[model samples]
Every structure is written in C-alpha cells, then in structure tokens.
Target chain A: MSKIGALIFGFNEYSLEIANNIGHKFGEIEIFSMSGAKEALEKEFAYPINRFDLSEDWGDLNERFDMEKSTAFCTLDDTAENIFLTISLRSSFKNLIIIAIAQNKESADKLSLAGANKVIPLVQTTSAMIADMLDKPVITEVLHNILYEKSSLKIAQIRVDKDDYFDGKYPTDIEWSREHGVIVLSVMHEDMSSEFIYSSKAKHHAIKNGDIFVVVGYERDIEEFEKLIGSRCDVSWSHWSR
Target chain B: MFKGWIVDIAYAINVSDSYIQTKRFFYNLLENDSYRFKKYFDMVMMALIFASVFIFIREVKYHVDDSLLFFNNIIISLIFLAEYLLRFWISSSITEVIIEQSEYDLMLSREFRLSKALRKIARQKLEYILSIRAIIDLLAILPFFHQFRLLRIFILFRVFKLFRYARSFQTFVSVLATKKFEFLTLSIFASIVIFVSSVLIYVMEANNPDSPVNTLYDAIYWSIVTISTVGYGDITPITYEGRMVAMIVIIAGIAVLAFTTSLAVSAFTEKLDEIKETKTVDDISKLKKFYIICGYEHISKEVAKQLVKNSNSLIVLDEDPKRVENAKSDGFVALNYDPGNIDSYKRLNIDLQRQVKAILCLRESDVENVYTTLTVRSIHKKIYILSLLMKEEHRNKLLYAGVNEIVYPKELVGMIAREFVGKPVAFEVIHALRSDYTNINIEEIIITPRMLRNAPLVADLHNARYRVILLGVYKKERKRFFFNPIDSTILEEGDYLVVIGNVLFIREFERSLYR
Candidate 1:
C-alpha cells in the first residue's frame, strides 16, 4: 500500500549506489541528470535515467509523482544546489515527502527549512557498519542487541502454531489485511530456513505450526503480536525505551 | 630627509620605472629567498662576516695602522649596518606571505576597526626587529659599538651565523635540545661533586708535599681531571682521602659519559625517522596504482588489514600529526595534510586524475568526507571513489559529488536482512559462486569478438559441454538487467552474461564458443 520511491537527482557514484541499493524498496525509482551526461553514464547503471534541466520548472515531474503514492529523494551533492532542488520540488508539490542528503549540520538545517522530511548526514554512514553487519547472526539477532541499547523499535521471532488463525492463509495476504503494530520482516519455514515475507516464494508459503515470524514494532504491539503467535524466547527489553 | 634622498639618488632612478625596478631588485635579494639570485646575496653576506671576523682577529694580533683599523672596523660596520636595515625593511612582507590566505576574516572587519590600521606597519616592523632572527642580524653588525670596548667581543657571535649555512648542525642542535633535561641534571650533579670534592681534597692534602693540592686552583684542576678519567700525571693524589675522592669521580664520570652517548644516539634515530616521514610523499609517487586512503579511523583499520598485503601500495593522508606518527610506526605511508584543501592535494603529486585508481574518504566527519570526495572527484573523474555516508540524508549529496560506491551500513544491512529472511539458501548459493580464483564461481563475461561469431541465444548455454547457468543478460545499449531472459532473446557483441557454474567449465565453454 506504500507508494514509496527513490528519486535520485544526480548521476554519480553515491546516487548510483543508492539507486542500486534502495531501488528494490521503492515501487518507483527515477534518476534525473543532464541529458548527454546521463546517457554516457547510462552504460554503467541498471536504473532508468531521465534528462533533467536544473534551472527549469518541474511541471512534468509534478504530474509524474502522485502525492499519496510518492516519496521523492532529492540528492544533489552540493549543499546550495540540494537546498534549491528541495525548494523547487516542495514548491511544485506541497504534500510530497522529500528526503535529501546533507553534507553538514548547517546544510541539514537549510534542507529542513526548504521542506525536506529527512536529511542524511554523511559522517554516520561509514563502512564500519558494513563490517559489523557482515558478522554471523547479523539480522534478527543483531536487532535484539541494538534494542538493548534503548531503541524504541523491538523485533521478536514468533512461532506460528497450527491452531493459530493464520494457518491457512498466505503470508502476504495475511499481512495486507491485518491491522496490528507488527510488520513482518521475514518468516522461517518448518525446515529451519528463512524467507523474506512477501517475496515471490514467501507469498505462496502457507502459515503452519513451528513456523517463525520475525516482526518489528513498539513494545505493546510486539507483546500483543506475541500473544497471538507464541514466542519461543522470553519477551523482555520492553523497559528499554525509557 | 626624504627629499634629500630622492635628489641624491636621482642618477640611479631617473624614471618612475627605474625606482620600481630598483625596489623589486632589492626585495628579491633580501626577501624573495626562493629566487635564483637570493643565495648569491647570502654568500656575499657570509663572506663579509668572515672578513670582519678575520680583520678583528688580525687587529688583536698585530698593531695595524689607525686608518686601516678605521677602514676594517668602521667601513665594514657601515656595510653590515646597511644590509641589516635593508633586511628589516622587507621583514614585514615575509610575515605577510606566511599568513597570506589566513587574513580573510580580518580584512572583512577592517572598516569597523580603522584605529588599528594607524600603527599596523610600524607595529609589524617593531615586532620583526625584536624577533630572534632580527636580533641575530643586529648582533652580526654590533662592531659599530667599537666605542664600547666591552661590547667588541659580541662580534664573535658572527660564528653563530654559520648556524644558517651548515644545516646539518641544526639537526644536532635540536637533538641536544631534546636531551636538555638529562644534560642539565648531569651538569648540576657533576658541578656539586666537583666543588665539594675539590674543597675536601685541598684540606686533606695541603700539608702533604707529594700532592699537587697546594692552592684551590690545583685542587679544582685535579678533581676535574679525575672525574674526566684524563688523570694527567702532573696532578696525582698522594693522601689516602684524595685517592678515595678520585675513585668516586672516575666512577660517576663513566656513568655520565655512557648516559650522554646513548641519549644522543636515540635522538639521532628519532630525527632520522622524522626526516623520512616528512618526505613520504616523494616515496609514494614512485609507485603506480597506489591507493590514497584519506583519514585514520576504525574503518581504515579494516581497510589496512586487507590492503596492507598482496604487494598493494597505500598512502594515508591525515590531519593529525599523532595519527601520522602512529601510521608510520605501524609501517604505513602517511602525511599530516588535510586532503580537502586543493593545495594539499597538489602537494601529494599522486596524479589523482590517472595513477590513483581509487580513493577512500574515511574521515570521521561527514562534512570533511564530503569535501574530500568533492575535491578528489574534481581532480579525477575516472577514479573509483569509495566513501562511507554517516547520515542517510547526505547519501544523495555524496552521490551527486561523484562517489562511486557508498557504504550505508544500516541501510545495506537492513536490506541484506530483509533478503536473508526471504531466501536464505539463495544468497548463500550466490556467495559460493563468487568468481575469484576459485573452482565453483559466478562471473559476468562479456561477448568477445570470437564468441559473437556463434550468434549464441539465451537458451543455448544449457547445451554447452561445461555447466553454466545464464542468470541474467546485461543489455549494453539499453543499460538494463534482464533476469533469466527468454530463449527468444538474442545476444550481441559487448553484451554481458551473469553466469553461475564451475571456473574450468566456464573457461571450456568460452574456448568452445570462441572456437
């Protein structure tokens, strides 16, 4: 139901990496750069590239991005240029969710004033995180370790019993209609193998006993979700938020 | 006085251009030290100094004529006086050049602080003359005070002028400076021992005729010779107490001598290392395809672990002297220069546009990382710029700055986590299929000229002798990825195929296809 998109504003290594990486999360991803320059860099990218004139009005872009269905990323490397892009995009569409990249705190403040919903600081994005993530039991296990550090979000692995109401339904369909705090990240099969929830293979897999669901939410939502699907481990870290 | 000087020098500067040229010429000789002719001026100054010292020594030894003495002392003094004043006149410009790019803010506020402008020139000249170098210059010409007979010995300070010419002595002097505390402690202890021992020995042996301890001078001289272990037989001890004192002095002297020697040796090694560290950039430029890793951090630790091996050359640029020293100790090429500045980048002379195949911007500050990436990108478009983005908001900005690869750990890990949950075995299979000197490997092989002759289609890969799966076809013209293209899909020259199979099998298939 989320019409999220990654709209990159430059044809660069940083932009291309983002497009390659964050592209899968978004249903719509559009890259804009200078015409011939975009075409020349086009050989290196798998994402679709569109020609954009920085000085022009965004009449065509406004028509393309539906407000309710779009989350646009304005990523020009220059601080002044990025602020101008945010201002231009925000002026064109008042309700659009515009996220931008900032080089420093000053630029972050300016981007926020220019109507960007979020500004990513460059310092915290070191390869050290990648080195940490590459260690074993990284995903769900590490999420628990981080939660102990006083994060508001909590992730718990729950076993889906055969007697549970979710047994006969598909994982994707169950998530679509369910109204709960829990967002299912992945599900582990009875065979002890995991699959991301809603993937082509995961969409058809039926819920069953001894099946594990890795869901993320606040403490209460996670607790309530735990009640519905029995958790193998003790539920704790609820007081971590304070 | 100004009007008289202009009229007196009219022959030398008949035109305005001539006046300007004369000023330019002196500015070069005195202040433009890096100029081709600055050294000749220094040589003349050095020769004048030696001549003055020689004349002074000659005057002391032989009674010279009154006029010749006047010429040697007064005329030479006059020449040095003019040289010293000329140097002082241009000294302010040297300070200005040293602080050139640093006065932008001061200039901006000049209108508000007009009162400070009144004495700025006079203040600069006064400050320069009071400095150590200026004082040294003044000392070299102080024979003008031949009026004060006591001050005439200060002319011997001309020997200090040699400190400027023989630069190697500067290193030795600095090494001595580093050992100053130890040397001071030794000197204090030795002085007290010598004084006390000489007084005691003189009292104990003054009545004995065999001892040369009659006067205080004889006793002092004997104590010094014994402490130095140079026991000149002309001053031997006769009394039992005197011999005991000599034994203690010789023991302390040997200990002090050993300590001094070791201290000097260690200091020399440290200075040698310091000298090598300063010239690291020169060493780096000789090696091609070396990576210039900017900044020192935990991330660089990981980078160093992997990159330090395999005959790969690396140079680190950091802003902290301590960090540079630490890197050197760990056997790394490092210099304390901020890579964000264009001047700093140019000094490296690494040919960033060509020879530097990759640059890693790993500074702790996101702003510095961004600025460094921008500078590097401007210098070289083809370089593979790898950077770590600390904030998600700056991703687009860094991407725009032309970073080839950005490691957003949280996002990338989150994505990987999401993928792992969906198809755990698939990623592992993909991982095992990585192509790098391995048997079972996956690689993206482009359509070679010979391979295009066969006009291979998507489904034709299964029929080949070697087992390789056609995972995807990378369309060159469209710049798109087609996962599992249909049998109807046609392949062309320059088209790349992402294949998964054994290394030897892939090679065999390639040979057969080309054949």
Candidate 2:
C-alpha cells in the first residue's frame, strides 16, 4: 500500500490541533509555516516545521513528496492567503487533496473555487447544535465520542467497480443498514454531485459503476461489506491505532 | 400622626385606606405600561375614541337618532370627563407636595404656612392642566357642553386621544419628530411658493369677468389646491397672466410635493430599521417561549433552521447590519443589535426568565460571547444561557459569565478534519448527518403519557422494527441518560429517546408511539 502523508501549512491553533489529532493516523506528516524562520523557531510544534512562501514554485515539493497520495491543508489565518495557497497547491499538483479553513460563507465559496477539496467553515453550527439537546446526555456523549474520541465505529466511502450486483437496483430497494450493518448516508454519482440516500433523486436513480456510497459502521463490518459488494473502500480497513 | 395625615392629604382626600387603594389601582390601569390591566384599559379607551370619532364624522353626513346623539354627546363625553378627572388626580399627588413643604419647613426650622402649601399644590395641578396630553383629554370631554356652540369644534380632538391608547402611534410620532428640521424647511419652502402664487394669481385674474377666482380668497384656495396637486377644478384662471401664474404654481407644486415625499421617505428609511427591531422585539415578547440567538453567522443560521423545524420560535440578533439583513432575507426574525449591550435585552421587554427558553451567545469571539452572556445574566439571573466558545481556554470564562452551556466549534471542526484526512468516508458521514444536505437526523422524542401508560418494556418497542437506531434514553427525573438501555428497562414518562435514522422513519416511529 502507498504511504499516506499530510502537508499542513500555516503555524496556528487550527493547524496545530489538526496535527495533534491526526499525528499517528497518517504514515508521515510535515508542517510548513508561512511566517519567517525566526517566529517558526520560537514556536515548539510536535512536527518538524519548515518555512514556505505562498509565491514560491513547488518544484522542491513535487520532488520531495508523492503528490498523488499526499494531502495538503491550507489553514492560514488570512482568508486571501489561504485561498492563494490553495490555488497554488492545486495548480502545481492536481492529484494532491487540498483542504482549507474559511471564516465565513463568502470565503468558503472563494476557497472552494480556488480548488480546495473540502472547506471547513469556522462556524459554530456544528458545536452549538448539541445545545438544544443538552438534556439528552446520551446523544451528546455519542456525538462527543464520534468527533473527539476514538471509538470502534468508522465511516467510509466505497466505490462500485463491478456493477453486476447493483446495476439495476435502486437505493431504497435494499436495507443496507439492516442487511450489511452499515448505514448508507449518501451516493456520489459519476458527475461528482452527491445526494442523500433517501433523497428523491438518489432513491429513483439506478446504481451504476463509478458511483460512490458513503457508509458508516464498524471497521470489520465495512471490510466484509466491501468484499461482498466487489468494491474498493477509499479509506483502508486497518485499525486506527490512536 | 403626620405621616398618616400626609397619606390622606396626598391623595387629596381625607378618606379611608380603601380610597387610596382604589386610586393606586386606577393609576396602574391608566398609566403603567407593564401592568396587566393597562392593556384592557387601553383597549377600552381605544374603542371609545374610535366610536366617538366615528359618531362625530357620521353626524356630518348622515342623520343620527336624537337618543343616539344624546348618548354620544352626553354619555361618552361624561366617560371622557371621568377619565380626565382621574388623570388630573393622578398626575400629581398633593400629599407629596404637602410632605415636601413640611419637610422644607422642618429643615428651615420655620412654621409650615397653609398658603405656601396651597400654592405649591395649585402649581402642580396647573402644570398638569397646561400639558399637551392633558389639554387633549380636556378637549375630548368638551362636547359634553353641547349648548356652547363655540366649544363644539373641540369635539374633533377626540381623535387625538387615540394617540395615547395606541403605542405604535406614539412611535410613529416620535420617529417623525426626529425629522423636525427637514419638515420645517419643506413647510417654509411650500408656504413661500403658495404666498407668491396666490398674490400673483389674485392680481392677474381677479378683474377678469369669466375667471372663477373672483376674490383673493378664491385665488389663495386655487394656489393651495394646485400646489398640493389636488387641482379641485372649481377655481380656474382665464387671463394669460393668470395662466402663467398657474403654470409656475404647478411647477412649484411638483417640486414641493416631491421634496416633501423624499424627505418623508428618507426620514422613515432612516428610522425603518429601528421600527423593525422594535416590532421584532414585540413579536418575541408575544411568544410564550422563544430562543434568543445573539449572532447571525453561519452557525446561527443553522441553529435557526433547526429551531424552525422543531417549531421553536427564535429571534436572531447581530451587530452587523449585513448579517442581520441576510437573516431577514432567510425569513428569520432578526434584529440589528449588539448582544453585549444591556439596552438590547431591555428593548425585548419580555419576562426573560419566564418567556425565554434559552439565550445562545454565538458571537465569533470568546470575549464577545462572554460579554453577551454577562449582559443576559445581569438582566435575568436564571435564564438559560448557551455560549459558543471560540477558544478552549475561555470555556471557564464563559461559564463564569453565567453561561449554562459552552460549545467549542473550532475544536470539533479540527477533530473532524483530522478524521477526514485519515478516513475520508467517516468525515463524509458525520458531515452529512450534521448538515441539512442529507435526510438523516438525530432527533430526541419525549415519551408521551400514553406510551408510558401502556407500561411497555424497552425491548417490546422493537426499534429495529422502525429501522431506527436507539442510541439512549434521557431520564428526566435522574437528569441522566442510559446509553443503549437494557431490554428490561421500563419506559417512563418524560424520558427522551435519542434516535438516529431517516427523518421519515423517525416521524413514523413517533406516530406509532401514540398507537
């Protein structure tokens, strides 16, 4: 298997947090600070820090890292700089997955347009959601465990390579959660647009090759389902060591 | 002895304690906005004002029965007379003046002269009589003296009494009052144009045999009618000079009309936001229980969406006008207000502890959220407050600021991003569930009395039959949640069942509970 590595840019709280949480998950990790070397030297980060400017050509980066398997993160505090970094990284390496952090909706749109694979808006929508259900401690704990703590539960996306099993089947025809012990959340079509499984568009559409199904379940159950369905999971089934 | 005497005299009556109590009651009903009885009193007074005005207007065009006229002229006016007297009585307390005079006499070590006390009391009553509101009230009762032909003109002032009963009318007046300078300038411009046009038309057209403007008064009327764009057509000019004057007056009229309209529109536009904010506050106060979200960012939008789905009322407040406008466009009751300002909460005018279910401080900064929580806490000590913690270190600070719940959005997002880097599918699932882009929902359904009355065990309900994963049950009495409760656990009232599944299936399961 090819090694999974992450290249995190910007030396800030969000970058450090992502680094600390996913330290042991990836095979290799590197940090690039956009600031001067003096400031980088002053800060003690768990990962070795390197200095990189947004304008620099990425010849060295391409040579040092396997661009296809590596993921780049643009976590700069400045919205314009982050978007510029995303555009630079995307233009240099088409296969390198790029993620970014945005302060608001406008910046999120700009970052996505700049070629970020995923844009995490620094919005309280996710956190403050549990406030209305504060009385339901169990739901809070379940969500807490899923987000912050490592549990046996895992979420994965599997691509349909062999269409024989599901080519003519509709999403609503099968009880994926009951039969396979996996909750099918959404289906990403060939056009890259995804819809919830229960959505009208997803429910009526016939399954085809190159379609991706996002599912959540235990690691063992996902691997079993992957083998039975003749599909390859994007995330490996290896146990999370954290 | 002096204090008892002062209390009696303060009410301007040497009656018993019940008299004082009755006066105090009437005072609350008449003037206290927060008093419950004031609403009913305002409603009655508003109805009377409308009725009296309608009757007076109807009498001009339609014949009213003699008895009805007598009832309206006497009975209604008598009611207004009683109201006027009560207002005059409550406007100033003679007892307070007497007490003040006695205190002053004692301070100076001099005798309390009866004439001095009488003069002070008379001055207080005179101030109330001279006040504009009091004068309107007096005019409202003038039709009672129907025999006095000159005083009958004051009967129309009954409409002015409506201003006191309808609060919105007062707001409108106050908003217009702010543009006093512009209106003054416009009125002055209009008057100069009217005066010149009226004199010119009178001089030019009055001598013409066929001109309708036979008198200076007719010319003045024509000038006013033309300038107002009404053009009554009853008055017209025949001579060429009069026609030229007419053209000039017409052009000047358009300018005056346009100027007045623009001035009014601009004035209202400036005050429109304030009026809307006040209306939103009023609407929130009417709600039995609603949430107050003190920020209109993305998170607040999401919260408001979910709250609307749950049938929970909420008002979104933000300091940024753009965000507030965005929230309004999104169909939420939103107001532009700084959450940290105590005046914002005071403007809501709701019994916070009773009417507000919770107050969410979702500002982008920890300091702002803390300040918001502090402001809310200062207003109501026990109202539930939830704050979004921007930094982990500020969690304790938020709690200290009287926040009942603290949520850290960045920390959650950071953890999710890490998971996404390692296991992309997991990230997708979690993201889909949290967002509205998917049909999946994690909902909490409270066990109804019927379900509890059935006395079914946890295993008997068959969550798998409904195809929903029951995560746990929150026991209300214990204030605890039992995760994946044992099959033998008996269902109880007030227990919230936390389940995750398709929204349709959740609804079906909830409906089945009643069966």
Candidate 3:
C-alpha cells in the first residue's frame, strides 16, 4: 500500500491555513493553485505547488498519486469551484477520499451531491475563531485539550433563541469567561455572517435572537449557559449529524 | 384454632413482626415469581382454572353429562376455595399485633398506634380484594353457582389468567400497556373521521329515494364499512354528493390507516433498537478512560489484543461488518461503521474526548487514516494518534495531519532483524522481559497532584524498598525524561514514572503510589 499524499486544490487563506495545519501529515504535499504560479507557493511552503485549471482533465493526478491511496481536499476559495473540484476528482479517482469546503448549507449539499465524502462548512468567523484559540494561555490550553484530550471541556455551537435578557445587550456585556465557565469563540449573525467575540466589529454587535455562538465549555457548564441565556445550544456541528 | 390465633398474637408481640415460612412462600408465589417452583405452581393453577372453565363451558351446552359435571364442579370449587383462603391468609397484616399492643397492652390513647394500625390493615384488605387479580380469583370459584347466566361471563374471565403463565401473552399485555396511548389516538381519530363522514352522507342522502342510507344509523354503518374497506355491498351511495363523500372517506381511510401502520412500525423498531442497545450496554460500560482503535486490521488487532491482555479498556471501529462481528465474537467490543464519517465519530461521544487514551489508526488505506487523524484532531486535538505508515512519504503527511507516531512495519521488522544479528543477547533479554507476562513487565505511572499532596517525594521512592528499578522520570514542564535520576531530584506533578520490575511487584507498587 502506498502512503497517501495530499491533493489541495486552489490557493486561498483557508487553503494556505489547511495546507500548513495538515501539510506535515502527508507523505507528499502538492498544491493546485488556480491563480498563483508555482514559484510563490513553493517558496512559501517549501513543497511542490502547480498552477492548474480545474476545468482541464486531471489525468496526470494518477501518475503523481496512487489513485487508490491519495486524498483530494477541495479547499478552493469559491464554493462552486470546490464543488467542481470535488466532482472532477471523484470522477477520476473513484476510490480516493475527497473532502471539500463549503461556505453555506446550499454549497454543502452541492458538494455532497457532487460526491465529496465530507463537506466542512467554512463559517465567516473561522479565521477569527482560530485567532481566538491562539490567544496567550487559551491557545496552549485549547491545544492541550485537543492534543492530549485530558479535559472534559469541549467546544460547542449554540444558536441564540428568543430571550428577553440578552435582546438589548452587546456581545461584550455577557461575562462568558471563568465566571460563566464558558469562553465564547464566535457569534454567527442572522444573515449567516459570523465574527469572533474579540473582533472590533463583533464587540459592538448587539445580541439578538437567532444568532449562533460557538463556545468552549464542559457539558454541564454549556447546559448552564443554555439556562442562563435561554439559547438553543448544541454540543456538535449538526450538519455532521447526517 | 382459638389457641392458634392467641399464639399468633403472642408471637407478633414477641418479634414485633414475623416473616413466617408460609408467608414468605405464598408472597413469592404471588409477588416475586420467577422461572422456578413458582412457575410450576402457576402452571398447575392455570391448568386447574382452565379445566374448571372448560367444564363450565361444556355445562352451558345443551347435552352435557349432568352427573360428571356436578362432581368436577364440586372438586374444582373446593381447590379454588382452598387457594383463595391461602392467599387471604398470607395477606394478613402485623398491623393487628401493633394495634392490640397499643390499645390493650400499652394502654395508648385514642388516635394512637392502635387505631392507625387497624385502619392500615383494613385499607390493605380493601385494596387487595378490589384488585383485578383478586377479583378474577374470586370469580373463578363463583362459577360453581350455575344458577345465574351472568356468572358464565366470570367463568370466561378465568381464561384471561393464562396471561400470568404464558410468557408470550405477558409480552402482548406489556406491549399494549406501553402503546395504549398510540392505540387510543388511532381509535379516537378513526371515530372522529367515521362520525363526520357518516353525518355528511346521512344529511346529503336523506332525501334521495335511491340511497341505501334511508336512516342515520344505516348511513353510519355504510360509512364505517367504506372507511374500513370492508364493504359488505348491502349499502351504496346513490346521490352524487353522497358518492363524493364516500370517495373522500375511502381515500382518507387509506391515509389514516397508513399513518396508524407507520406508528406501529416505528414503535416496534424503536423497541428492537432499545433492546439491542441495552444488550451492548451490558457488554461494555460507559467509556471513562479507554483506547479507540479505528480499524480492525491485523496490525490494529495485534494492538487491541495487547490492550485487552493488559486489562486496558477499548472500542474497535471497522468499516467491515464481518470484521466487526468477528471481533465481537472474540469477546472484544467492536462497532461496524465507517470511522471517517463524522456522525459515527459523534456517536463515539467525542465530546468527552479526554476519556480517549489514544487513537490507533491502522486502516489498510493510509489515506483513510489520514482523514481519520485530521477529523479526530479537529474534534479532539489533544488525543494521541498513532498511525501505521503504508508508504515512506506518508510519515510526514500523517505527522502534518496530527498523528503522534507513524509506525512503519517493514522498517521496524528490518531494525529488529538487524538487532538480532548484531546484539542477539540484548534483543532476547528485552523480548523476554516484556513477553514473560507472569514475571517481568515495563509500565509507566503518572505523578498526579493528589500524589504530591499525600505521598513521599521522588527521592523517597528510590529508598522505599521497591524491587522495581526506576528507568526514568518524564518531566512535563521540560518535556524531557531524566534517566537514572539522583535521589535529590525534585519531583513535580504530571511526571511519568517509567519502571521495570516483576509483574506482581509492579502491580503492588502502582497500587501503593496511586492510593
């Protein structure tokens, strides 16, 4: 059995971050940048990056990777391109695992229909959420929890239901820290826009019903948070429920 | 008999209360019955009840043998009467003893223990006698009085008592008890639909001379027959409006009937699923601290077998159903589901992610393992991930994917072969130490804050008369393992104490330090 290499399609902030976060785990790392030249990505990542058009046949992919062993990650900036990449790769490599990213539910459905094994929805505040996780002791602690999994504390996404208490309040008003046993990661607006609570724009955003908050806490503490805010909080990303 | 009553009062006073042998036997027979002697007792009682019922049913017939019927009736009546008296005797309360003690012996005042005890006994008797089982028992004997036709119904009630003896019938009754709400809902909806349709048909066709529903009652019967799809052809709608109502009724009947069928199917499936889950619950406990091996490949199997041998807890997930069933049959906890599926991962209760010791990703396809590692890392970044490297390049990929260790089988075997040729004695010794389960073992124990709070320091550990040799102390802060540390080396919380010793000594030593 050949060791699986990573096939990252498209070049974007998410693509770059994902490449960096997951680049070391693969035997061979290749980036298919639609807009950038090979020089930039190779210099940046110290790995091979090729300029390619997704519309073209990826016949060379079979030679580069054992089609039976490689995983194709479609992290193209545009949802449609990712869906396109998913379909193209799936058509070529019938046995390979194809993962694609979607910006919303509709694209997720499209990517899934296009034969992506997993479609992770990229929320608006993902970068900011990552930044929040990188904060001084919090990042180390979060990393510790993720790496060692030695604590019961978990990250949960909760929707802000209709509540009288938080209707007129700002995001900064709620003490979602040690006192409440929860650290608010980000807040998703009714328009599907999301921002980390620490961001300048989010700090001023007024709390409203139907907004979703991503928080990190223990199960009981999360339940307690639900009780206090009267919000419908979920312990997992429900899109994965299917 | 009077002396016996007096003795009962004396004994009750002597012991405060008594669980007499007869009382216990009868109590168990009625209340705490199992598939034992009580089962046989029930079978016998059921047979007798059914026989008496059979005789009564025959006597109701025109040409029954009168003389034999009378003899059998008298015999069955005597047995039922005796059983009934025995049940009554067992139900007697110690309340009377307390009452007598309070009222006459202790000379307690009104509204004291005496009156309360008497009231309790009276209430117990009232409750017992009025209970359905007790009523059925009483009715079974009353059938000997064939004078009244109404008593014949009670004789039929005796057959209902088979529910107590037959397991399948008992389950039927139990399922009905749980599903009464659904059945009730269906019945109520049916009734409403039937009533409305009947009224509409009756009102619309009342003036039509050709209509079979000349009367309101006939329209109701016609409506029910149409809705049930059991049309007897005796009644038919004549007017166009009446025919439309009948068509609507038929269509609505199918829809409502399908809904009822769906409810039954869902309920039955839910019950089966509950039973299956509960059986698994008994096979394994809620994972507090355990290892998760993602695939049951040969490599992962070897890993899991060792974990089990060492008494470590684990759950194995394999995409292959046959492999899953195979592992389960071998007395290991296994689940058949694609580990790459996030929902299956969620089912793993990854929220309590810390309980996971480590994830051994040994999928035949390294790509799947990489995805699994990425997913597991995304959800629980702190969990240790060990993957078997299928290709040389996958090492870096797996590491980038957040795999803690990538074991290359060929490389490991090659290294071991080289060691066997160059340093045979050392290899043998190392292998022997680990393989000799009954004698030697290597183990790691972490130093917790609780240990620092109560137990002796690291220096004291060296002199604690331990037969085990201290191999190293892993410092969490510095992320370094100091081998052969000096006695004065200060110990910190979260230090791993790596040691080699006799298996028994290691076990005892671990127990002492952890305790």
TM-score of each model's chain B: 0.47, 0.76, 0.48
Runs off by more than 4 Å, candidate 3: A1-242, B1-19, B56-62, B81-113, B204-217, B273-515
Clashing pairs in 2: A155-B426, B10-B95
lDDT (10s digit) by residue, model 2, range A1-242: 44557888988778878877777667677888877754645456568788899889988777778888788888998998999999999898877888788877689889989888888876534634554454334565555555544666556678877678875998878877557877676787877676767667887889888788876667787898888775755553221111
In order, candidate lDDTs are 0.65, 0.78, 0.65
lDDT of 3 by residue, B1-515 (tens): 55345546656755553446656777777655331377678878788877766776676666667776675566766777787777776676554555455555445443334445557668778787888877877877776776776866676766766665665565445545567798898889889989999999999988888777888899899988888877798999888898999899899789777877787666667676444544454343446677777887655665666567657788888889888877888778887767777777765544335567777787867899999888888877687777777666677889999988666543433333233222222333344334533255546677777666645466666422455556456677987655446557777887777665566677777777766
Per-residue lDDT tens digits for candidate 2, residues B309-402, read 7687888889899999899999998888888898987877778878888888877788989988888888789888887887788888898888
DockQ of 2: 0.25
Report how far residue A158 has shifted in candidate 2, in Å: 16
Candidate 1 interface RMS: 13.4
- Candidate order, DockQ descending: 2, 1, 3
Local lDDT at B219 for model 2 = 80
Instruction: Give each prediction's DockQ, rounded to 2 decimals.
Output: 0.04, 0.25, 0.01
The CA lDDT at A217 in model 3 is 58
